[model samples]
Target: MLEESIRPDNLALVIVLQACGILAGKEVPVNEKGEKTMALEIGRALHYDLRTFMLEFDNFVCTALLNLYGKCGAMIEAENVFMSFVSLDVVSWSAMLSAYVDQNCGEKALLLYRQMLQEGLQVDAVTSVVVLQACSALAESERTLVIARNTRKTAALEIGRAVHADAYKKQFAYDLAVGNTIINMYGNCGVLSEAEHVFGVLNIRNIVTWNAMIAAYAEQGEDEQALMLFKEMHKHCITADEVTLIFALKASCSMGCLDVCHCLYFDIICAGRETSSLSASLIHAYGRCASLKDATSFLNELSEFHLGSWNACITSYAGEGDCTSSLFLLEEMKLMGIKPDGLTFISVISACSHTGIVVEGAECFMSMSCAFRIVPEGKHYGSIVDLFARAGDFSRVNSLLKSMPMPSDESVWLCLLGACHTHYNVELAKYAFDHALMVQPKHAAAYVALSNVYAYAGIQDAICGPKGTN
Candidate 1:
């Protein structure tokens, strides 16, 4: 239109800006060079033309420009447009706050929020929702910081609660998006009850609301409750999305609810929503329910495999005591270039231990750190020790114990003691028993293993022998 010498009015420019904002919100297709294509360039051109037309100072146009730039990940340009506002209204402030949020600049959004409040502007529902999201992002950052510094002073949750209170005071709590954000904020803070309370009182419920509540239950290990809510959601005729299905599948897996799993699996198939995650969840659920055949069948139905799907199927086989199948899947996964994660190795190593494949188990354990760059955790160490102990490799067990960065725990000691009982190694059983007691005085398995060791040695009278007796 501009090339034809057609003069577009402010209304036309506003519509163009709105289109740009929508395009920015959608995932822009990138070219081979990883740069966004012509849509973003058109947005920039429209922005420049708005400046040329001197309509940039108009509040609505300015807010739209800010939104468009923010959605495009052009935070600097968005901030520039926001600063150009001669008089900031609630819409402008909200747009800028949303822009900061879109760019994941949560701290900046919070700072802008403080400035907005100081200006004594009346915050509306949209503004409240944006601020709540900023609070959520800040809460996540606080969690990361707490983990890094090993401190528990998290101000983000407090800020979020205050925001929630403010939303209620402003009568914005009834807004669907606002209510959902509040639920999500509380859920993310590990306050499931508060999330549930908010969910219960929500005058209107949507799929997002149900998903949030279900996810909260699933996250807190309330699988039964999550499934119950899912049923309730169905009664209300609310459709489940992929997220809802994922949470439901997780709850089913946790509780070994095979009936629920089968129902959800059929629903997924009918809906053509068979994602890798869902398939993985089905495999895990079947495995937990002691149906390795069903799990393997489900895994085979997948046209493509992700690392998670592979891991789940491998774990299912391992759990079924099918060590051969587990190892076979591991090799297949490697051949397919799906790098095994820690969980994969844990399952694979456990399978080797079960089948007494000592050499392969040791090689897998070593490859975790050597080839995969995954430093073995305590569980991996425990699995390897169990493997060696099962093979009666007492020297390797001792060497692994010494190589451990931290002191051995009760489980590790229990594994060693069990091996001693199996081999009638009286002296090593005494050592393992003492270490286990040091770690956990009431370790029942360790005590039982020690007793069995004495019985196997025909020294039943010395069951409660001297502390250091062999």
Candidate 2:
């Protein structure tokens, strides 16, 4: 009705609404009174035609459309709309580049950034930050690393410093977000001292700054310093959330700090974020400390048990050499309709090996493929072979070897060979050794096992070839 009347103000309002429709990823819902006001207001801005629909829209409207497309991974649509513009400015370029980088097309982002530079477009802070991220992403490939390292060496931190330096030639060292990026860049580059120096001088510190430092320390296995900094974080009233706690728990687990992990577990529970993975970590910590009862009780108390939680408890029991409990848990998992994954099966097989439950282990191995359709990996096969070999079922072990659809791994062959040597089966030991050697040509362990077999049988001289009869 408004378009037929040729009302310029009403038509502008419709154009605005249409742009918003594409921006918000929805069609505009109808409203009357508000439409009239918007129509009158947008009339003061640009006019639009069919091809100029996106481009002639207000900057805010156009940018929002680009953002929506970028965020949703409609890169082609985004590019089409971006290139449709008769005039391309910095914000327009940044929007498109951010989309490319965010969607993991970092190399393309870099190419566009170079094009932007060749056009003498003035890059602003947000644009520089996006390019910095692309630099970090590009660091994984050596060829890409050279490009990123050179770009970062020029643009990221030094630009921040230079921009500040140009103010009466006085360099201001601290811009919170920029400083944090520099800290991150330095930390990622393994220049920890420089990162620490930058971090110490920063006037404002956010969780990102702290997280960067903590991750840097954690990656280096500096658990003590990471924990100390974590304490400092709490003192500074920076509440450590899930990401913080997960990394701390990993450090605690690595350092065998069961008491610390236990305390964190209660803290997590009190915070009302009892995620299964967190609970699993607690079980792992307790299990590592040989506290099987505590691990079992913790698992039982949880309202829902996931695969990780179950695997943690099973592995704990197996590690403690209590295969019966591990087997019991495996059965319970099945009864609960939780089919065993590869890790779960391996944990149970380990338990059986420790406790000499040969028959049960064999049944579990068969069930892995037949019932679950989970093909046994080399590690799983090795564990089962070890179980049977340890139980002195040489015939069963030989049959398993012959029946394996996949080639036997070196570890599997080694397990069988070790068992043969232990049971004084010389012929079987020789066969196992040969197979192991076939799998791993430079297997010094196999050579040692074979020499011992000959020595034990008082045929060492023949094997060593009475070659000078040394």
The candidate maximizing lDDT is: 1
lDDT by residue (61-81, candidate 2, tens digit) is 555456555555556766776
Name every residue pair that clashes in candidate 2. none
Please give, for residues 371-430, the per-residue lDDT of candidate 1 as tens digits: 989988878888999999889998998899889997766778887788788888898888
State each candidate's clash count: 0, 0
Q: Cα lDDT of all candidates, in order?
A: 0.82, 0.71
User: What's the true lDDT of residue 400 in model 1?
Assistant: 90
Candidate 1 overall lDDT versus native? 0.82
TM-score of each: 0.65, 0.61
Residue 195 error, candidate 1, Å: 2.1
Worst 10 residues of 1 by lDDT: 144-153
